[model samples]
Every structure is written in C-alpha cells, then in structure tokens.
Target chain A: MSSQAFTGGHKASHQELPPEFQDQEESIKITGFWMFIVTDVLIFASLFATYAVFVNRIASGPTPAQVFQLNTALIETLILLTSSFTIGIAIWAMRQNRQRMVTWWLVLTVLLGMAFVSIELTEFAGDVAAGWGWHTSAFLSAFFLLVAAHGTHVTMGIIWAVALLFQLRRRGLTTVTRRKLYTFSLYWHFLDIMWVFIFTVVYLGGRLI
Target chain B: MHGGDEQHETAIEPGFDFISPRFEEPKFPMHQVWGYAASLVLTFAALWMTVNRIMSPSVLLGVVLAMAVGQAALQLGVFMHVRESRGPAWHLVPLGLAFAIGIGLVGMSAWIMLFKSGVS
Candidate 1:
C-alpha cells in the first residue's frame, strides 16, 4: 500500500504510512492527543481526590447508599462498556478501509453514548427532585461534579462523532479523516476507563461502605 | 508486467524492509474481540462481587480496584493502541509524568485530609 495508490502522489513513501500516521505532521498530532489524554487523567484524578475527601460528609443529606441505585448504575455501565467496544470495532473498520462499516459503528457508538447520558440525566433529576441537590452537602457536590464532568465529555464525544460522520461521507477515508476518527476513539476509550473507576469507587464502594 | 514488478521490487529500498513487517495488515479483528471479551468478563466479575456481598468491604475494594486497573490496561493495549506511535515515542514520558502526579495528588490529598491535629 503506497501513497501513490491512494492519492496519486509522486512520492511512494507517503503511502507506506498508516492512514492515521500518514506523515510527520499527523504523527505529531497523534502524540499530542496522547498528551491531552494524560492531562485529562490528572484532571479526573483531582476530582476523584475531592470525592474521596468529602465522601463521608453527608451534612444531614442523603448518603451514597440511599441516593445511588445499583440497577441504574449497572445499566449505565453496560451501555458505556458496549459503546467502548463498538468504537474499537469502528476503528478496526477504519483500518480496513470500510467506510460504511466505520460510519455505522460510530453511529452505534454515539447512540449508545446518548442512552448513557439520558439515563445519567434522569438519575440526576431524580436526585435533585428528591431534594438531594449539590448545595445540600459536600459529598453531593463532589459526586455531582465528578459524574457531570464525565457526562459532559460523553456529550462532546457524540457531537464530535456526528461531525466526523459528515466528514466521512464527504471525504471518504483520507488521512485527515482517519486520524480524526482514531483520536476520537482514543478519547472515547479514555472516558470508558474513567467510568470503570467511577463505578468501582463511587457507586459500588459507596454501597459497600 | 515483469518490468513493472521489478520496479516495484526495487522501489522498496533495503533498510525500509526492516519496518515493512508492521505494514502487513491482519485479516481479522482478533485483538478487538479479545479486548471486548476480557473487559466484559472483568466488568461482570466486579459487579457480581459487589452484588453478592462476597467479601468484606476492604477486600472488595481491593479486588474491584485491581479489576479497574486491569480494564484500563486492556483498553490502552488492545483498543487504544497506546504504543503504536510513529516515532521514538517521546509521548510516553509525559504520560508517565502525568500518572505520577495523579497518584501523588490522590494519595497526598487523602493523607492531608485524614490526618488532623488532635485537640482533646
């Protein structure tokens, strides 16, 4: 597979690179995205620390055992885990140059993400309606902030994937499009990993403790 | 056709072939399949542990934390292709630094908050 075959370029070496790493510029961009993920990891870590500190401070508010629903958390976990799997398959399809398959998998991923967000929002609404708002306690505040930040990221991911779908329809599987999709998959997977911790430390731990 | 084949053969310089192995694409999505299966198993295991009340709180936390770390590693290695950089992989240094800082931030915060001056 040479760049000449795909793009009719004179230089053959360009085609040798993968679609995501098609050149020095794209390669650097991928590395930079990795760094961005690292920063995001630290941000989540700080939030997790804050949550740990205030986890016991109920201040006459609802405890985690009272507010958290295992069934809802489990459903959200399954949806997100499925989305992560679909996004992986989407990237795999991208590497195989199957544009339609990639697009559909990404579409599935976005739908699953939307489901997760909807469920999360509903849970929050229930909490607030029950008068367990963030202002009620430090524990609730930290919990809301951590979970909402993740929800915000997933919302952004859905928007990004939809935009990429349009790009894929217009441009096909060019180097630029491929790199963007690849980075998007990385971001999605990172969020899934964060969710793993959130479920374990927040929901399950809260119930157990 | 023979001449074109010869040209194609010669176009790939000697040293370039050393890196050509990676260019060979796989026919199946085996890695993704395995990653998905492993992640599902880990998720269910943690859920079952918590749901069944199979262990004490401290033990359950340790087991769940280990599973969380394992799931993250699976995503990074199999799904994210964390090592599939195009160059010398300078990106890893910053990633390592970030993890260090993250652990320090979490641990130090807990220590600072948990340990306070005593006033009897």
Candidate 2:
C-alpha cells in the first residue's frame, strides 16, 4: 500500500515521499506526534475550562481589564505569529536542501520565541509587583496557571530549537534531521494556534466582558 | 542531480517505471504565503474589533472565537501539512475523537459552572 501510494502520484519518481516522510517509520512517528498534540489540546482545554469558571472570581483584586495590556498582547501575538512563519520557511528551505537557510531561520525563530517569553515574564512580574499575584484571587490564580503553562512551553521550545540548530549544523539535512525538523515545525505551529485562543479568550475576552 | 539518480535507481527495480511529470509535486511554496496572509488578516480583524468596540461584548466574543478557529484551520491545512499522511491515516480517527472530547470538556464544564445544573 505504501509503495502504491508512492507510485500512484502523477509525479512518481524514485523518491516518492517528501524528506520528512521518506520512510514508513518516520511517517508513523509523525502520526504519533499528532496524537501527542491531541493530548495537549485536552490539557489546554481543561485549563480554558478552569479559567472560564474563575474569570469572574476577582475577589477584591485587579480585574482582567486592569491587567491585560492590549498593546503588549498584540506585540506578543505578532512576534509569535512571525516566528511561526519563519519556521515554516525554515522547513521549506530544508526541503530545498538549503541547510544554511534552515539554520538561519531556525535561529530567528528561537530569538522571537525568547522575546515572547521575556515579555510574558515581564507581564507576570508587573502583576505580582502590583500586589495582584495569583494568591490575590481565583481569577488571578487561573490566569497565572494557564498563561504560565504556555510560557513554559515557549521556553522549552526555544531550548529545543537551539538543540535542533546544533543537530542541523552537524548532520546537515538527512532524513532523520528532516523528520525532526518537520515535527518541530508542527509543534511550533500548534503553539501558535493555542496562542490565538489565549489572546482571544483570555486577553481580548477578558476586556470585552 | 539527486532526483535523476533516484529515477535511475528505481528504473532498474522491477515493476517501477520512470516517474512522470504528472506525478511530480509542485515546487512552489505558495501555501505558506497564503497561510501567513490569512493569519495576519484574522489576527488584525479580531484586534480591531476588540479595540474599536465595533460590537457588543457577546457578539464580538463569538466573532473572535470563530476567527480563532479559522486561523487554526489555515495553520493545520497549510503550514502543518496535517493531511499529509501515509497508509490508512488512523491518526485522524484519534484526532477527531480528541476534538470531540476537548469540545465536550470545555463546553460541559462551562455549562455546569455557569448554569449550576443541567436539569435546571
């Protein structure tokens, strides 16, 4: 079936699969990664549910309106969005066999991701300094937990990207490296999608309500 | 050069013919460009609505949420290549189930918290 699928395409050639899907094993691994992403969806969904329940539980603390800075959120959104784009381009470059371009774009992605984390940390620090820490109210607690979870993910992604950069430098664009890069891109894009929800439901919706 | 080598290698193998142009994948990366533009438009539109107070809170919330979902679709379809799979694509089965379960988790939790009782 796999061979037929490879040959069935009109462009059937010796290389039937993309670099990332070059092997049946690699293809299955990508599918497994998707499953992992589904579980992550559930984790975030539960957090969203918790936030919804506590969004109104201010309890004599700073409200969402007072806390969320639209300009900052917008900037963060743009940064992450642009980083996602760069990573996509990186994968595209990798497919084109442009190893240097891939490394450069990946580095850019890591930088932008770092900027996002720093901005998020600044926001959290400001809140805590203003006596609006998570302990102040249920709303604040939910807010902190949800946003922090995302921030932690971004931090880890930066680390992962750096590691991938080293691998790309050392190994070039072999199938194994390509598969890893592809999965990393998927993970990065998934995080951006999650941020869309966070910006909408938490930051924007907080102010709207 | 690598592609030519692959074709030669496969030609020697039994039951394999030289790949035709019809089977060739498109070389352009236009999908990524389209996804990026769509994402930017959706993001700015949601931000504009929130900043300008263009609608009631409830209406704006619904619109923004809808836009978020659309953005996700664009990302999955274009950037993530979510449909690119090998074999029978059993992964999508679990993915579909996950989506249903996620929606149920969020929806039921919100309902229970907001309404206090399903029977009520």
Candidate 3:
C-alpha cells in the first residue's frame, strides 16, 4: 500500500510539472513572486472598486475639486516621476558596478520619495483642517483609504531602499544584493504605477465630478 | 587599422569562456528611455483633463477613472514588468478577483443609492 501511494504521488507530481522543468527551487520562487503581484493587484482593484461605489457621496462635505489642490498634486507627481527615473539610473549604475553613483542616486531617490510623502500628508492635514474629515463623507473615507495606502507603500519603499543601501555599503554587490535591488525596482515601479492611477482617478476624476 | 601582421581583427581571441556574462549596455534603450516619458505624458494629460472640471461632471469623472485605469495598466505592464515576468499566468490570476470586485462595487453602489436610507 505504501509503494502504491508513493507511485501515485510521483505520478501526480509529474503531471503537474514536466520532466525538463522539474526543478523545484527556482521555478517555485518565480511563480510565487508572480502570484504575490497578482494578489497586490487585487488589493488595489478592490480599493478602486470601493472608490467607484461611493464616488458621489459628499455628505454635505467637501468634494475633490474643492479639497484637492491640483498644483500640489502636480508637484507631488513630478517628484515621484523624477525619483523613479533617478532610481532607474541608479540601477544602471549598479549594473556598471559604480558604487558611489549608486549610493548618491539612491540617496536622491530617498529624499524625493520623502518629499512626495510629506507633501501628501500636508495636503491631508489641510483637508482635515478645512473641516472635511474622513468621516465627513463616504467619498472622503474611500479617498483616505486609497491615497493613504499608496502613501504608506511609498514610505515603506523609501525605508526598504535605504536598508538596501546599507546592505550594499556593508557587503558590496553580491548576488543577494542584486536580487534585493531587483525586488526594490519592482516595488518602486509598482508605486509609480499606483500613483498614475491615483492621480488620474482621485485628483482628476474628483475635479471633473 | 594597424593590423598588418597575421593577427587581424578576426584573430583576436577573448580569454574568458565563449558564453560570457552578456553585460553589454542595453541595446534597446527605448524601453528605459520611453517608459517614464510615456508615464509623464499620460499623467499630465489626465491632469489637464481634470483641471477646472473641463466637461460635464459625470462624464469627466468617468473619463478620469477610465484614463486612470489605462495609466495603471501601462505602469504595471511596462514599468513593473508584471506581464513579462517569468510566471505571467500567476499574475493573470488576479483578473478573477478584480471581477469579483466589479460585482461587489455594483451591488454596493445599488444598495447605498437605492436602499441604504430605507434600511436605516
């Protein structure tokens, strides 16, 4: 019975993975990363959907156009876009084995990321000070959740990149460093992408509505 | 140009293995160069449309949301390389979840718009 069960399990495994691609370690991790991205995508998608549901709700509160400062948002957008480009160049520097260039570029990216978050938080503070609290309306609640989620991710990305900088400083560019950098780039780009949506939907759509 | 000896340009032999780390700088720099440019244009164009509420409020809202979705797709597919990653099928799995989100959004919107006051 034990031998039969073993054979059955082997056959099941073989059916799942072909012979040539049977390596478990690398393929699993790559697939796992993809799955992780998909899950994150769903999280954002749900947020988007929620925003859509209550988009018209103001509860006699401030609307997007009245609340969101287009100029400030534009400034924040520029900051994030430039930082992404700088980080991309930093990755290129890493590829070229230019350590000092990498460090400086990453430092610039961190500062820019911080600048974006501070401006965003300031905008939120201004909103609250203007008597438009998160509880004021369904729209405000959804807006806070979505934008705050993205802001939190950016803050986390800055921290993660700085930590990577420290690791690179201590150990130089090893395979581990390369993998970390690759993951960080993925994250930074993801943040940029989410910003694109937030800017378009929240800022723009809110004004239009 | 001064290869008068038998050792011509073709005679040069690299010391390393035939398949070395192909670390030549990116040939198709278009992806790197154009990625952010496209993003900026899309973002600004969206912002321009939003500024001053350029059209009917409802229509503008819908357009902005649609454009945002497009922008997000560009960022995810191009910048994040989500679709081009090793296991794209795994990434595609979220489509189902997004569909569920759509259903939930429509349902919740209807509930809130049509029934929330009645229930309260």
Candidate 4:
C-alpha cells in the first residue's frame, strides 16, 4: 500500500494520505514547506519587533490614531478570514476527489484574497495621498514595512494560486497537483494568521494607548 | 468488506499504535465550521473591546494579543491540518521552538525599545 497510488475518498493516513502525502517524497516536501513556514515566522517576528519599537516614535508625523482607519482594517480582516475558511474547504474537496467542488472553492478563495489585497492597497494609497507616506516618520515606516511585507506575500500567494489553477487543469488531480494545492492552502492559512496578528498588534493595539 | 463510504482503519499495516498520525474526512467539516465561527468571534470581540475602551490600555493589549494567539491556534489545528501527517509529526518540533523564540523576540524587542522614550 505504501507504494501503491491512492484513489482517495476514504481516510488519509500512512498508506492513504490522499494525493499530497501519498508517498515519502511528497510528504517530505510537505515537511520542507513547514520548515519554510518556521523561517517565515522568524521574519515576521522581527518585523513585528520593529513595528512595536518604532510605534511611539511619531516624530511630528501622522499618529496611528489619525492614519489608521478602523473600518478598512476590519474589512480586510474579515475578508482574509473568510478566504482562509474557503481554502480549507478547497483542500477538503480535493481530498474528497470532488474536482468541480475543489475548483469552485479555490476560485472563491482567490477572489476573496484579491478583495483583501485591493482594500489594503486602497488604504495605502489613501494614506499616501494625504501626505502620510512611510518617509514621514519612524512609526509610519515600520507600519508600512510590516504591512507591505505581508501584502507582498499575499500578492505572491495570489500568483501561486493562479498558477496552481493552471496546473490543476493541466495535470488534473495527480499526486503532484494535490501536493501543490495542499501547500497552497497552508500558505493561505499562514497569511491569514499573520493578518490576525497585524490586526491585533497594529490596528487594535494602536488605539489602545 | 467492500463498502463505498465506510469509516476505516489502516489495514495495509499490521500494527496500530499511538503517535501514529490519523486522518479522516467527515461527512461535514465540523472542525472547520466551528473554527471559523470562533475566529470571527475572537476577531470582533477584540475589536469591540478595544474600540469601546472596555479595559485599561495594558489589559486591552494583553487581551487582544491573547485572542490573536487563539486565532493562530485555530488556523494551525483546524485549517492547516498540522496533525495530519504520514510520519511521527516531526514538523511540530521545529515549529514549536520557532513559536517560543519568535514570541520572545517580539516581547524583548518591545520592552527594550520602550526605553528610547525615557531617554528623549
């Protein structure tokens, strides 16, 4: 069973790990992705540190109370959360071998991700238009650095997802495609968790003081 | 023995023991649905508490940060399928350590940098 290709729909385990971890090499790749996530955690940790350290250093520029739009941040958070759930469903559908359902769920996740990024970009553009650029102060710089870094990751995830859709179409639900989708869901969920911290630390915490 | 949608254990192997990863896809995504609801609640509860100034500043920060941790746990457990693996779940070792170190870095950096306000 370890060497046999799974025709999934039952349980996924050592011998039936869906298509993603259906083999040793495939699961090892999955583990490598987790290691990548660990590194990402450290990267974000340092960025969070920078943001916290510089938050109070407004240096005669716009304070978070002035620049932070609670409404926009709330919208972005909600969108990302929903997208995370959708990607979970997408993977579930993949395991169930419901190809069409998987496709629909992935499409929904991508659209939601696009909406989240759009709102974030609009917020940034609004700030810049009002002369509250990242260059204005240490606080703004840290804020942009942390957030734009997350936004850039979201952008990359979107590209990865779009490319994955093409792969799914081309390769169908082979072990390769399933592994790719599984990893993409992990990446998507990781981004949502990062956004959770951002909302708590940057947006809500900004108004705490 | 040949049912289409029966719950099953691994028969391909002779031994079943603890610490071995198990996987199941239920008829409904109970974990995911509940996790989604819980996350939304945590997100808004934190937002409402902070927006209304329901607590002192320090306590509010602590509460929201704790909620953020809760959200992370939900994503890791429910969405990421962190426990579902083919091996001994070795990935959690590095990930757990990273969380400890990462949290320390964030906390220490904040504490040390606050002294700049005192200097100025």
Candidate 5:
C-alpha cells in the first residue's frame, strides 16, 4: 500500500501484490467488521432479555412506577435521538469524502453526545438527591445497570469518534481510514439501538408498573 | 510475455481473485427525502402525543424508544454500510452482544440471589 501503488501510478499488472494481501484483504476486513457487530448485537440482546426477566424483581426497593420521571426522561430521549441524527449527517459527509465536512459534522456529533451524557448524569444526580440510590432496591439496581450501561456505550462512542477525527486529520480518508469509520458508524448506531431498550424497559415500563 | 514459460500457468491464476485489492461500493446510498420525511413525521407525531397527553407516560416512553431504534437502524443500513460489508464480519457484532448479555444476566442473578432471595 504505497500511495502511488494505490493510485495506480506506477505498479505493473503483474507486480503480484504482497503475499498476505494477494487474495483476502477485503474479505478479512469485512469478516472482522461483521464479527464485531454480531458480538455487539448479542451483548445488547442479553441486556434486553435480562432487563425483561428482572424488571419486576423489586426485592424491597422503589418500583419503576415510583422512581421514574417521565417528563425529564422524555427530554433525555429527545436529546439522544437528535444526536443520532447528527451522526447520520457525519457518516454521509464521510461517504462523500468531504474531509472538512466530515470533521465538522463529527465535531457537532461529539458535542451533542457530550450534551446527552451531561443531561443524563444530571438526571442521575437528581435521582440520588431524591434518595433513590442504585442499591435502594432491585428495581433501582436494574435501572442503574441498564441506563448506565447504555450511557457508558455512548461515552465510548464519543471517544471513538474523537479519536477517528484525529485519525482523519492525520491519515485523511484512505481506505483504511474509511473502513475504520464505517465500523465506528456501526458502533455509534448500535449504541442508539441499545438506548431504545433502555427507554422502553427502564423508563416507560417502570412508569407503567 | 516477460516470463515466456508462464503461458500454461495462466490458467492457474484466477482473474477475479478472492483477495481483490479493489472495492467498488465505497459509499452507502442515502435516500435523503424519504429518510428525512419519515423521521420528521415520526418525531412530530411522538412529540404531539407526548404534549397532548394522548398516550400514558409509560406508553409515551415506549414509543420514543421505538422511534430511536428505528432511526438508528436507518442510519446504520443507509449511512454506515454495515449490511454491505463483503465478509461475514457482521456476525461478530451479534456475538459480542451475546457475550455481553450473558455476563449481565449472570451477574444480576447472582446479586439478586445473594441479597434478596427471602425478601422478594
């Protein structure tokens, strides 16, 4: 992969690509990327199922109906949903190979992500202030686990996006960088999907119960 | 012709190699009009329902979650090119998800048994 070779400037057709990359580079990358996504899907699936099984296992703690604030939860939900939209724009920019555009869109995505997390943390603090600790009961425990896990994923996504931003600057949109971004986009969207479960099981279900 | 003895061996080399260095579909296609319109309708409906108190609080929450999942899927399929990956690497995504679930379930069950067995 020299830039010249990649751009088809010099190498002859019979140059025989490097042995390791002669026949499986794209296949390998594709496989690796899909494997990563499948594993992640399984992880989120388990969380959803677990939350379902233990949703009512209050074990002498505040129930979801008692602890959840639907109004504020709605706001948090909107923030995250909007952020996902921004990230979609970022991916579109990447596809167009608009370097500056991608960079700016990612920056916007990172900012929105930070805002979502900050709002969530504030909400958590408010819950604590009202004396609803994670250990207060089984319901709260599950609540903390489900929502916090999703939060952690969002945080990781923000960090990943930022790192990729730097990589974009240093490496530009090379094939390697493009693949990396494609993977990260998958990851970011997956995080959004996981939050859907959180909103349903923890927030809405909690209130209904 | 550089190696004149290679004429017979040309059959050994496949034209379309499995490890093809080139990739054709570099970008995922976007249906901006449809995606935007659908998203707007969904969001507006969800918002109006929430504001007007049509759905119960819990139901509202569920609807919101569903909306998010829908939007995320749209982005992944349309913008991320996950489904377009040449190999089965998408399988790893699900596998990772399964392991994460296993750990969460086992850990939570253990905690419940340890602390709340008699109570609940």
Candidate 6:
C-alpha cells in the first residue's frame, strides 16, 4: 500500500506538500493516525478518571505523599520532556533531509526514553521491595494502573523508535518513511502532553494538602 | 477550461472533499525551543506552587490544572503541528471533541468521588 501511495504521488500530486503528505493516500493515513490518537485520548481518560476516584482510598498503606518522591519524579519529568523536544527537532531535521541529524537526535531521544523507563522501574521496584504494591490499597492500585499504563506506552515507543531507526537506514527518506516518522513524533508529543497531566494530577496532586 | 468535460464535472462535483492541502513553509524551529523552555517553567512553577502552598489548596490545584492544559496546547501546536494539514484540518474537530470529553470525564469523576476525597 505504501509503495503504491508513493507511486501515485508522482503523477497526480498537484499540491506541493511536505514529503509525508506528497502522497494523497498517506495524508489520509495521517488523519487516520489522528483518529487513533483520539481513541488513545479516551483510553487514558478512563484510566485518569479511575485514578482520580481511587487516589484517596489508602486502606492499609502509604498515601501518595508518602510514596511519591519529588526529586526523582522531577528528574523523570524533565528527561521525558527533553526527549519530546528532541523528537520534534528530529522531525524538523527530517524535513530538511538531514538523515544524520535526525538519526542522532532520535538516538538521543531513545536513550532519554530508556533512562525514564529505567528510573520508573527502579522506583516501582523500590516500592515493591519495601512492601508497597498495587494490592496494598485502592490508591496504590490506581496509581500503578495509571502510571504503568504510561510506562508501557513509553516502553512501546522505545521499541518503535528503534524500529524507525532501522527503517530510516534501509529506506532513507521517502514519503512513506517521512510519514511514519512524523506520526511517531506526534505520538511522542502526545505522550508528553499526557505526562504533563500525570505530573499535575497524580504526582504533584499527590503532594497537595 | 482546457478540457470542457472536466470543467463540466467540476461544476457538478461535491465540495465536501476534505482532502484539501496547505503549504508547510519551513523555517527555523524557534517554536520548539520556546515551547521546551515554557514547558519547563510551567512544570517547575506547578511544583513550586504545590510545595510552597502559595495559595489555598483547592485554588492551587485549579491553577496547576490550568497550566497543564496550557502545556498540552503548547506541545500540540508547536511540536505536533496540529494545525498543519494536507486535509481540511478536520482533525481539529475530532481532537477538540476528544479533549472536551476527556476533560469532562476527569472533572466529573473527581467531583463524583468527592465522597472519598481528602488531604494527601
């Protein structure tokens, strides 16, 4: 389908668009990705709603203020935020057809993402070893579910970035590859946006009186 | 009309084709740099406000939530290129509706569960 879309562009593309949108079908695919993001928005919304409900339900365990560490969460937040900026810059480089710049920035972004996931895992491990698991209370359950979901998304993103790096190597910058990278950047930024809320409503809100 | 029949069909064709395109003028990404800086400021401000208890608890919560929304908007526009389109920007319609529903879901759930709410 992608090859077909690429070929279709050369003859019929009247509108000068970014390389990703040079193919009409691929532009529709971009819109489809947006729809996918809309669904994701709802998915996270439900979890956030659940988290809000259970946030105060510490049956026999620590409260969020007791469990969450401001310093660590702040570091993780900044790392992920910087990775988001790096990916945005990567896409900017892709538009200019600078493969090396895009590749270097993507590598940096992936490394940052790995750092975030590892830090989160270590945090969770520390909690579990100290005997605070999701089973401890409704609040813990909600916290784990909401945050783990985002962590899982980040894990998946790391994998996707590695895969995209491979594709960029094999295919160089084509319309198809450009679209894929652009969509991934969109997903990354969306995740950061979600994290902004998580940092606010979950981490920071947990520290509130 | 170079082709009379083509022009005739255009006269009869529906205008609801959403596949319209727009030019994406390339420039230096100062937007990204400013967005990153602004986002950092917002994060630290939220943290500081939370830590210092600079306002009443509820008011601080409200302020931080507003900042989160602003940060999301900044990333969406500057980084995600939400307004750039090869289509009619129909995405903004669904994405907007999604936010409305998502925000309503979070706010309503928090409000409804006020029965279980208290200090951290």
Winning model by DockQ: 6
Query: Candidate 1: lDDT over CA atoms?
Result: 0.83
Q: Candidate 3, residues A157-202: lDDT per residue as tens digits?
A: 9999899999989998664575566567767876776787778767
B1-120, model 3: which lDDT tens digit per residue? 232222221221355222121122342335556767876786777777766567887777667667666666665554444432211133444544654665476447535765545532
Which 10-residue window in model 6 chain B sums to the lowest lDDT?
Answer: B4-13
Per-chain TM-score of chain B, candidate 6?
A: 0.74
Task: Order the candidate numbers by lDDT, best to worst.
Answer: 4, 6, 1, 2, 3, 5
For model 2, how does the per-residue alpha-carbon lDDT over A1-209 read when each residue is reduced to its tens digit?
13134334643443666755656567668878988998998899999989988888899998899999999999999999999999988887776777898999999999999999999999999999999999999999999999999999899889989999999889988878889898999999999999999999999998788
Q: Residue A64 of model 2: what lDDT? A: 95
Task: Arrange candidates, best TM-score first.
Answer: 4, 6, 1, 2, 3, 5
Per-candidate TM vs. native?
0.87, 0.87, 0.73, 0.90, 0.68, 0.88
Best by lDDT: 4
User: CA lDDT of B72 in candidate 1?
Assistant: 90
DockQ winner between 1 and 2, please give it: 2
Cα lDDT for residue B92, candidate 3: 48
Candidate 2 stretches greater than 4 Å from native: A1-15, B1-25, B116-120
By lDDT, the better pick of 1 and 5 is 1
Query: Residue A128, candidate 3: how far off, in angstroms?
Result: 1.6
In model 3, which regions exceed 4 Å deviation? A1-31, B1-29, B52-63, B83-120
**What interface RMSD do all candidates show, one decimal each?**
6.9, 6.2, 15.4, 5.8, 9.2, 6.5
Work out the iRMS of candidate 4: 5.8
Q: Which residue pairs show backbone clashes in model 2?
A: A10-B22, A10-B23, A11-B22, A11-B23, A11-B24, A12-B19
State in Å the error of residue A159, model 5: 1.5
- Residue lDDT tens for model 4, B79-104: 99887676556688789889999999
Question: What are the per-residue Cα lDDT tens digits for candidate 4 across A1-209?
Answer: 22233334334434556656656677788999999999999999999999988898899898888989899999999999999999998887787777788888999999998999999999999999999999999999999999999999999999999998888888787888889899999999999999999999999988986
TM-score of 6: 0.88
- Poorly placed runs, candidate 6 (over 4 Å): A1-14, B1-25, B116-120
